[model samples]
Target: MHKIPSSEITPEHLFLSRRQLMGSAGALSVAALLAACGVRTPGAPATDTVPADARTDELGDPLNSFEEITTYNNYYEFTTDKQGVARLATGFQTSPWEVQVGGLVGNPRTFALEDLLAFEQEERIYRLRCVEAWSMVIPWVGFPLRRLLDVVEPRAGAQYVRFETVFRPEEMPGQRDRYYPWPYVEGLRLDEAMHDLTLLATGLYGRELTPQNGAPVRLVVPWKYGFKSIKSIVKIDLVDTMPTSLWMALAPNEYGFYANVNPAVAHPRWSQATERRIGERGRRETLMFNGYADEVASLYAGMDLRVNY
Candidate 1:
């Protein structure tokens, strides 16, 4: 019921740094022009189409069109090509989906799709920065992961959380070709899993998640690169030791266990100093912890980020 406050909303006259409005047009007119052109500051959207009741916070950048965000994505289970993954994911069924929680927990259980949705939902307009240097602003509908984890309380020794994606080569074409590996896996520290910001997303753009975008359920950790938020999750296991992520197993040098968004720590293949926002024209300076430093900074105090990354 409470709305999450965001950064001060920049006036329309100030939103466009790349292009200056000519003449003595009033600031309100500049705002209208930008609205007509579908432009906003950077990470937030100018016009948030999501219903006011559904939203807990408004992003500063304009929301990417649903078509652009959903159709253009990286779901390796379907296909490697961004344009092709959406079509390939259509064959998968999600209505009766179940998520099994186990390992080092006091009460392990399997929850049906509707069961997860029974909890209250909130809309969070988050900046999804990809490891590949592209990003998008998405309005995700879900509840804090801590709510679900509480149902299956972690034991004292549980220090990490491992996630597994559904493995179905028959339905997912990429799995058949042995792209990266079948049944994509990812993990996070127990603290990270319980973070208030972490979400178990069920829908986006005010609707159920499409198969291509990890239908049924998925993890959304805004501070880390997009890959840390695994898709189409089927299992969550609390473990004493850190779990191996699909990207870490595939290329540990390029991807790290923490995977926090840091402009200072560059991926082996590319620099992390900047990111290209999808549908936007240019790159923006990458922020520390993807602009969530105030919220999650204390989680990693003495540890060197450059090495952990």
Candidate 2:
């Protein structure tokens, strides 16, 4: 766990300005956002560069620039376009939010946004590997999902956890499309949900998350493909049976329930052997369990990852 230094964190003024510029400019390109915020455009010489060794994760991968992390996103609830989410999500409401935790729990309760924030927050620099062969090193601020789970103790026979994102078709235009299911949902095995590495992320880069980045709260399971870390979470449920995730329901042959990162198990359309890290030049070999096999591998002891994935 490499702690990010204060100097490496994005300056507050620049973060605010970036949001303001995006709101006023309306659907500007990511390059335009970077240039307006005085950040070097991708592939250009950086005028303000951090040390090569600074702001790295445990694997020593340098953190992606704040611009790259925020501007480049895969929030399907907003749109399928990666860079367009930021613009469309500018007005998505997050405050006054509540997350209901129930279903086979002893002390079922709904936690308000402020209540969720009250938990002791810490920064965990993590590598977010998308299933589309792209990746980013993000410094997320939040506590373990287990902390919240403990509050609503899982009763006996609870074997899985289900997560659902908030639904507002009026604000989220993509949800209005009838082609796919609305109110995205995901799930994890009970033990996987309790793992210390499973984080309910609230913010990134030392700032509260923006709508494009899953504002208010979201899940961050570092060892799994990025989609498993569901965004804009509003409901959590403990169940005795495996929950059918949105992706799994949509394309069962393509997406699986486990969703653990395994370089050997390729997606139906492409190989998962290598991924392009944002802000980096070339592709790098994908790792088993996203390089956290040592920590999470035992969770699937004796099970074939290729089959589960």
Q: Highest TM-score: which candidate?
A: 2
Tens-place lDDT per residue, model 2, 23-84, is 76775676686565564455433233333335898988888877777788999999999989
Q: Mark the 10 consecutive residues where model 2 has the least summed lDDT.
A: 44-53
Tell me each candidate's RMSD, in Å, in order. Answer: 15.3, 15.9
Per-residue lDDT of model 1, residues 89-116, tens digit only: 8758887899999999999999999889
What 10-residue stretch in candidate 1 is worst by lDDT?
46-55
For model 1, what is the C-alpha lDDT against the true structure?
Answer: 0.86
Quote the positional error of residue 68 for candidate 2 in Å.
0.5
**Which one wins on lDDT?**
2
For candidate 2, the TM-score is 0.84
RMSD of 1: 15.3
In Å, residue 203's CA in model 1 sits off its true spot by 0.5
Candidate 1's C-alpha runs over 4 A off are: 1-59
Clashes of 1: 8
